[model samples]
Target: MRGARRVPRRRVIQRLVAGMTVGVLTTAIVFAAMGWFPFSALRPREVQVAETARIAALPTTIGFHDPDSYFMNDADVNQTFDKMLATGVKNVRLMMPWAGAEPVQNQFDWTNIDRTVNAAAARNMAVVGIINASPQWAVAPGVPAISGRPASPAQYADFCAKVAARYKGKVSAYEVWNEPNGAQFFAPQPDAPGYTELLKAAYPKIKAADPNTTVIGGVVGSVTDWGTWLVNPVSFVQQMYDSGAKNFMDALSFHPYHYTLKFSDGMAVANSPLDQTVALRRIMIANGDASKKIWATEYGEPMTATDEAGQAAYIADLLTKWQEMPYTGPIMIHTTRDRQTGSTDPENVFGVYRTDWTAKPAQVVMKDAIAAGIPKSPEFQRFSAITDPSYGEVLTPVYRATPTVWAQARTVSTLFETPTGIIASPTAVADKARQFGGIPKTPFQNGYQDFDLPSGMRIWWSPATGAHAVGGGFVQAWVPQLGMALTDEVRDGWSTKVTFEHGYITWMPWVGFQVTMT
Candidate 1:
């Protein structure tokens, strides 16, 4: 019995040993296959600053046929000036009637102009005086009354020189003529020959008077295909460039009035103001004059007694759009107050203010838009602060304002900042974080995390729990509202709990949290 029990114990021991060895080998193989014993390497780190680009200028101006006549008295002028200054406007555009200045040959009456200039200067606003109108002495005695029409290029040059010399530094910029391509004043010309000649002669005179002053070409009217050849703004501009008129002016100016239609309709026409600008830019680029900027000297949609809200919306849209386009410079709405003349069309009511100088709804809307920041999409954002309360009253011959919100957002989208090795502020860090998540939020509520985990380790985040549940991450952990897909890892979270707060939970998906395992 003892011999039989000993033999059985040896076989059992051999079998147990073999079973233990196989189990250990299988566990080792499984660990090796899963690569669980090896360390994972962290990805390369890239940091970027999310700042908006400097957008195009928003210079607002007032179009005044005659400031003295329109305002009536010195008190009225002063009142208007005060209002304009309140709007954060820096420029005004006034048409210096050639006839009014030189009613008699060589006799210049600078009384009204001097008063206007002094008033504007006191308010710290620059003037862009457009020398227009034809004096009876300069034109054929029988020629119908219009803006100045000098008989010859030499005559025009002389008048321009005189005006430029008188104003000198007081006037920041000068325009040679108004609408030369139109039959209104620059009548009877082959293309823009008459206008080009006038520019060539006046350009030197203007420079001679005041080298510091900028000279802009007169604002052309229509550029539509249906427009007459003489009034075809595009043709006139092309011809002017062909004739070496580009070297004369600091900026090319034009009137982009979209008539009575809504802002969207005006934007839609084939050869509308915006489209014409694209064509102008191409021409400027083609002519190697890319440095020259285009100015919309006169632009606005007419408001009516019945449709004030529509007018307000149109103005808001126009300003917002202007803020977004990088090439658009200054935009001067046609008139600050509705005029008695010019047109009897009830739709000719383009006044931002009523006749009594009180602001219209459109005026309030503009102030609000500028104050809140011009929205990029009319559907998304609000206006900025009212930097100027009397923006409706004062004529800014050369007004320059800041870009709207829409412009700012677009700028941020394309913005890239080179590292300067400077420590970033809390606000700056928050901004960057928001940008990374494709969600915009105020800097105060930005969420962040810090970690000190070991190197050569990767961190991942998910709404799920347990091992191997990493890849099936939910965008709910990322973008809670817009339902965006997670395609990229935004940042590395250190040994800190990142808690996002408020509307930020779903509102700003641009920030999130994750932890690393060593």
Candidate 2:
């Protein structure tokens, strides 16, 4: 409804380019030579440099949705931009409300948006604009009178074209609409085909107006219809593709508000934003659109219910995971300042700063991440292969992977504790190290060492035994009935044995593991 503030749905609680100076190009080449780069310099010079910088510039991994920046007083606006810059924010996401700018069919006022865009430009910060809110005149007759959808797709296209034309050089990208999958934002009841029509109409027009501007589509919210308020985001994205939305936009965007769910929960739980994003990627891959990136345009926790420290930790965790995903792009936090300092409403407290402009723990975390250049590294977590049917393959980031021996320390203490540090393994044993996890830890005793796996399994190695995985239900049964293994696995013709602190477990070729408690 037009009556509501453009706050995000109540439920769920949930890149720069240009100015590639010669010096930066030189730096890019130098980094490439040292094996640190967006691309290898194995290609032609012109194409290599441009593509490299463009890749590096992408995903704009650390931006904030500073809607308040559009309405701030001149002094506050300048101050806010300064704060954002000091924290290393590479870009700012602004709300370009269509209704406010185009109230009466083409009669336009760009005062607020102009101020915000100009402020960001003055500081050399890129701007990603959210073009939303349909004016009353644009709503088609008999439409459900929802707040942000226009009557005809062309009406929205016209506005997008106008915006792209007006701020061609200043704005870097535009999101078609915000959360159109939610009845709260779209009209005629959250129809994917309907939203795709808008994207199909607007993409070409916006490109024609400003060819360099990126048009991001599929701005769906992370929600499912509990009743009639929302459409399942994963299914909605597929519907968009079915409606031929694949070629209409440069990239797809979604709001990944976790609400009460933690980032870890998203990794393991079924319908989390992270899980949904994976499903959406699968959909894209199946449609042969695998190269397209999925941007998390809005993500954050409201401090009213989630503690400040908790918000910082979750955001940090989310950023690390985002960096690990090759298909992901920028992850923009919801807002810049609390809408009201002490309001109980979650929307009012999503900001990393209080309304009075004091910093929160989340702001500090953002500052540190930006300063670190948002490095890409594995999260020392249980990894899942995108193609694995049962989660066995170990996936390491191309760069900054944890050292094999040290990485095994996550589950096994002996590896990090033993003085027999970094013993060499035989070629046969080393070849299958990844199957266990990383390199083997030092031999815990005279002739035996262990390799820990991400799946909580361990591989025991000895001159006599060579190497073999010893885990699964057998290990589960062994740990309770017996204690930690006291000796490496010993094999005789047809059986295997491992002595534990209080007992022993014997394995027969056909009979599996049998434990004997002392």
Model 2 pairs in collision: 140-151
lDDT of 1 by residue, 228-308 (tens): 434456777888888888887778887665544433333223455654655566677677777777777666555432366
Candidate 2 lDDT (Cα, whole model)? 0.65
Candidate with best TM-score: 2
| 315-366: candidate 2 lDDT, tens digit per residue | 8877776655667788788767787877888767888887888999999989
lDDT of 1: 0.49
- TM-scores for every candidate against the unseen true structure: 0.58, 0.65
For each candidate, what is the lDDT?
0.49, 0.65
Backbone clash pairs in model 1 (N, Cα, C under 3 Å; residues 3+ apart or in different chains), count: 34
